[model samples]
Target chain A: MSTPFLKKDKTGICLKLHTALYGHDAIEQFRGAYGDGLTFVRRGAYWILSFADALEEDVVDSLDSLLVLSRNRKK
Target chain B: MKKFIKADGWVKVPVQTKAYPLQAIYSAGYVFMDKAYLYLDLEAKDKVVVWLKPKAKADLDKLAMEFCQELLNYAHYFSSLKVNAESTKLLLQRALFSAAPSMVKEAEEKEIQDLIKELEQEEEKENRKPVKKGKK
Candidate 1:
């Protein structure tokens, strides 16, 4: 599935995932998975995922899995 | 050769892409994050222009030198990491071995013994060095 909020730039792609409420916990998870290629920046109430160009597919897949799991857990 | 030009208060340093890749340049830029505001531009297919604007009142020449130094430091850092990648992986694996609960006790014991033996040998080599006597 495509990430609707994902935006492309010269450096890489960015996803608007609002995980700021969870603090650094959620950020740490993505960092552990993506290593140095990915960074998370807090913009207002939302967290933005800035990822490298090479790992665009991996980032999208991981985000999809994360979203699905989170939804399943909630149910 | 690296080229440097001073324009106003900003120093523009030209770095070859072959000598230092974008990743290394970016790493060096990150190191100067608190000290200067950095702007990177592609001068050519093989050249990158780094514009450094000092945050405080500092010598432009010195800032240029420091930026070049930072670039070399990052270049060496990345090259060394590439060289030691295999050894680093081995070190990490050894470190994580103890965390694996399913690992065999006998194998862990042997690994510990081998590490102790290596440490003992290193200590012995250190002790074998002659002490220098001070002149009276």
Candidate 2:
């Protein structure tokens, strides 16, 4: 389930989320939940969550939940 | 012995999941925190690819070997803990039992008395110090 924001590169697949929409805390939460399979890096105002090839599907599912949680917290 | 591929300034080490689980990889990475920047990737199903980049001017080969050794150490530690889990649980229960409210109160009372005695001894030692006579 790849979204427009999620794409595959030479290294692996990455999901890019805006820091404004998710905030910095989301990175830590995602990393804690996914462990080594998930690596996060901040590029300008966006946080990119890169997942290993083997973990692409799991990362996508986790990302969906993270976005849902972020939306709920906003309300 | 596991083989690691060296390229440029980074070492790509492959770890078998059956021998060293993800936890062991994490532990090994933590142990090498000061020496190198460790990255773990599960590109394959049963293997973890560990990329170790030296943080300082050091021997990459030696660091890679040390990282492998650390993984084995953690694997052994984890396996031993699993084997002794029941004994550990029992020990913890006994420890908690021994640390009941009554036992804690008694220990606190003893500690307070010891602290008071030490303070009094310090005061006495200060009192016995020779006083400097002020010039008239």
| Per-candidate chain B TM | 0.69, 0.68
- The C-alpha stretches of model 1 lying farther than 4 A from their native spots are A1-75, B1-3, B99-101, B104-136
Report RMSD (Å) for each prediction in the order shown.
Answer: 19.6, 20.0
How does each model score on TM-score?
0.47, 0.50
Question: Taking the tens digit of each residue's C-alpha lDDT, what string does model 2 give over A1-75?
Answer: 333234776557887765544556755676786776667778876677778765544543454456434434432
Superposed Cα deviation of residue A37, candidate 2 (Å): 22
Candidate 1: pairs in clash = none
Q: What's the C-alpha lDDT at position A70 in model 2?
A: 44
> Candidates' DockQ values?
0.02, 0.02
Model 2 Cα lDDT, one tens digit per residue, B10-123:
788888898897677766766676667554545466776776767688877788888888999999999999999999998886697587868667778999999999999999
Candidate 1's residue-wise lDDT over B10-62, tens digit each?
A: 68888997998666776777677667756544556787777676778987778
TM-score, prediction 2: 0.50
